[model samples]
Target: MKCVKTQDAVGHVLCHDITQIIKDVKKGTAFRKGHIVTEEDIPVLLSLGKDNLYIWEKTEGILHENEAAEYLRDICMNENMIQSEVKEGKIELIAEIDGLLKIDVDKLRAVNSLGEMMIATRHTNTTVKKGDKLVGTRIIPLLIEQEKMEKAKEVAGDRPILSLIPFKKKKVGIVTTGNEVFYGRIKDTFGPVVAEKVKEFGADVIGQTIVNDDIEKITKAVEEFIEQGADMVLCTGGMSVDPDDKTPGAIKNTGARIVSYGAPVLPGAMMLLAYYEKDGRELPIVGLPGCVMYAKRTVFDLVLPRLMADDMVTSDDLAGLGLGGLCLSCDICTFPNCGFGKGV
Candidate 1:
C-alpha cells in the first residue's frame, strides 16, 4: 500500500476502511476498502481527520489486512459456526446453533502469540445461543507478511482451533432423598428445581423417586433410574457430611466411578459427581447439594451444559474451578454470564 495526500487521493482505491466516529451518534465504516476515491470523498475524509490515505497497491508475498483476517478465520472456524463478511479487515465467527463452545486454548494462545494478528473469542466451554458472536479475527496492521500467516497456520496444526458441540436431548431421572420429604412432612421442592434446570438443556425428567435417608433405598433408587433407561441421574439433597446424609454413600454403592466427591466452589462444595457404567455405556450420576434447590446458580449450573453435551468432567476439571468458583449471590443474578463457576 502507498500513502498519498487525501486531497490528491481522487481515483485511488482505498487500501483499508475509513472509520467515522461521531461520539454517541455513530461509529462505523464510512468508506470500505477497494473503494475508488472520488473527488467528492475528499471533504468527507478530511472531516474525519484523514490527511493521508493508504492506496491499494498489490505486491508479491504481502497480504492485505482482509486477506490476513480470512486466514486467521480459517484457523478458528469449525462445525456449527459461520463467519461474517470481512468488514474493516476483521472477520467474526457466529454460532450456527445453540451448543457448547469449545476453544483449543493452547493453539489459540499460540496463534495470538504470533504478533500482527489475533483471534479474540468468548470463553471456552461455555454455552452459546444460535447467532451469538463466537470469535473475531484480524491483523494489527493494514498489511502483513504472507509468511507470518503461514507460520500461524503451522502453529494451529491441521485441526481448527474452535468447535461447537450441540447439546443432546437426554432422558433424566431424579432421586429426591431426605426423611422429611419422603415422609410427606414437606413438599419435595428440590425435584422441581432440578427438573426445571435440566429442562433448560432440553432434557426430560422421566421420573422422580422419593427416598428416605436409608443408604440401601437411596442406592436402589439410583439403580432403578438407570434401569429405566435414564441417560443421567440426579440425586438431590442429603449431600452434607452429617450422619444422616446418605446420598454420597448411596452413589458409591451403585458402583459408579466417583469423579469427585467435592468441588472447589461455593454453594456447592458438598456436591458429588460420579458415572455409573452399564453394558458399555457410562451414565452420569450426580449428587447435588441443597444449595442447588435455592441458589440461583451453583456448580450444577456450570457442569450441566457439559453433561448434556456428553462431555465428561474429570477431577482436574473440578479442581480448576477454584479460580472463579465463588458466587456473590447478587440481588439480581446474571449467572453463566457472570464469573460464578467460570474458572478455567
Candidate 2:
C-alpha cells in the first residue's frame, strides 16, 4: 500500500475503508475499499480526519486486509454458518440454524498464534439460535504477507474451526423417584421440572413414572421406557448420599455404561450419567440430584445441549467442567449465557 495526500488522491483506488463517526449518531464506513477517489469526495475524506489516504499497490507475496479477512473466514466457517459482508477488514460468521455451537479450540488457538491475524469466537459447545454471531475474523494491519495466512490455513487443517450441530427431536422418559411423592405424602415437583426442561429442547416426554425409592422399581421403569421407544431416560431425585437415595444404583442396575456417578458442579454434585446399549441402539440415562429442582442451572444444563445434539458425554468431559461449575446465582438468572460449566 502507498499513502497519497487527500487533495492529490483523485483517481487513486482506496486501499482500506474510511470510517466516519458522529457521537451518538452513527459510525460507519464513508468510503469502502476499491472506491476511486474523485474531486467531489475530497472534502468528505478530509472531514473524517484523513489528511492522507492509502492507495492499493500490488506487492508480490502480500495481500490486502480485506483479502486476508476473507482467508480467515474461509478457514473458520463450517456447516449451518454464514459470513457477513467484509467491513473495515473484518468479517463475522453467523449461525444459520438454531443449534449447538462447537469450536475446535486447539485449531483456533493455533491459527490465532500466527502474527497479524485474529479469530475470536463465542463460547463453544453451547446452544445458539439462527443469526447469532458466532465468530469474527480480521487482519490487524492494512497489508500482511500472504505466507502468514497460508500458515494459518495449514494450522486450521481441512476442517473448519466453527460448526453448528442441529438438535435432534427426541422422545424422553422421566422417572421420578422419591418415596414421599410416590406414597402421596408430597406433590411431585421434580417430575414437572424435568419435563419442562426437556420440552425446552423440543423433546417430548412420552411417559413418566412416579416410583418409590426402590432400586428394583427404578431399574424396571428405565427398561420399560426404552421398550416404549423412548430415546432418553431421566431419573429425578434419590441421588444423594442419604440411605433413602437409590437412583444411582438403579441406573447401574439397568446394565447401562455409567459415564459418571458424581460431578464437580455445585447444586449437581450427586448427579449420575449413564448410557445403555442394546440391539445396536444406545440410550442416555441421567440420575438428576434434587438440586436440579431448585437451582436455576446445574450440571444438567451444561450437558443437555450436547445430548440433544447427539454428542456423547464421557467421564473426562464431566471432569473438565469443574473450573466453571459454581453458579453465582445472580438476582436475574441468565443461564447458558453465564459461565456455569464451560471450563474446558
Candidate 3:
C-alpha cells in the first residue's frame, strides 16, 4: 500500500477502513477497504480528520489485514462455530450451538505472542449459547508479512485452537441426604436448588429421593438411579467430614471410581466426584457440598456445565480451579461473566 494526501487520493483505492466517530450518535466505517476514492469522498474523509490515506498497491509476499485475519481464523476455528465476515481487519467466531467452549490456551498464547496478529477468545471450558461470540481474530496493521502468519499456523499445528462441545441432554437423579430434611425437621431446600440448576442445562431430574444420613440408604438410592438409566446422580448435602455426613462414603460404597474427594475451592472444598462404570459407560456421581444449597455460585456451578456436556473432569482440572476459585459474592451476581472458576 502507498500513503497519499486525501486531496490527491481521487483515483486511488482504499487499502483499509476509515472509521467515522460521531460521539454519542454513531461510529462506523466512513470508507471501507477496496472502495475507490471519488472526488466527493475527499471532503468527507477530510471532515473525519483524515489528511492522508493508505491506498491499495498489490505486492507479493504480503497480505492485507483482512486477508491475514482469515489465516488467524483458520488457525482457531473448529467444529460448531460460525465465522463472521471480516470487518476492519477483524473476524469473529460465534457459537453455532449451545455448548462448551474449549480453547487451546497454550496455542492461543503462542499465536498472540508472535506479534502483528491476535486471536482473543472467551474463557475455555465455559458454557456459551448459540449466537454468542466465541473469539475474535484481528491483524494489527493494514498489511502483514505472510511469514508471520505462517509461523502462527505452524504453532497451531494440525488441530484448530478452539472447539465447541455440544451439551448432551442428560437424565439426572437427585439424592437429598440429611436427617433434618428427611424427617421433616427442616424443609428440603437443597433439592429444589439442584433441580433448578439441572433444568437450566436441559437435563431432566428423574426424581428426588429424600433419605436420612445413612450410608446404606444413600448408596442404594444412587445405585437405584443408575439402574433406572440415570446418566448422572447428584447427592446433595452431607459432604463434610462431620460424623453425620455420609454422602462421600455412600458414593464410594456405590463402587464408583472416585476422581477427587476434595477441591481447592473455598465455598465447595468438600465436593466429591466419582464415576460409575455400568454397561460399558462411565456415569458421573457427584457429592455436592453444602455451599451449593445456599451459595449463589460454587464449585458445582463450575463443574455442572462440564458434566452436562459429558466432558470428563480430572483431579488436575479441579486443582486448576484454585487460581480463580474465590467468588466475590457481589451484591448483584454476574456469574460465569465473572472471574470465578476461570483458572489456569
lDDT of 3 by residue, 200-311 (tens): 9999899999999999999999999999999999999898899889999999998899999999887899999999999898999999998998999999999999999889
| 174-229: candidate 1 lDDT, tens digit per residue | 99999999899999989999999999999989999999999999999999999999
- Of 2 and 3, the candidate ranking higher by lDDT: 3
Listed per model in order, the count of residue pairs whose N, CA or C atoms clash below 3 Å is 0, 0, 0
The parts of candidate 2 lying over 4 Å away from their true place are 3-29, 32-54
Q: How many backbone clashes does candidate 3 have?
A: 0
Q: What TM-score does structure 1 among the candidates reach?
A: 0.89
| Model 1 clash tally, residue pairs | 0
Tell me the lDDT of model 3 at 200.
94
* TM-score of decoy 3: 0.88
What is candidate 2's lDDT per residue for 295-337, written digit by digit as tens?
A: 8888889989999998888898899889998988899998777
Candidate 3: where is the Cα deviation over 4 Å?
2-29, 32-54
Which candidate would rank higher by lDDT, 1 or 2?
1
Candidate 1 clashing pairs? none
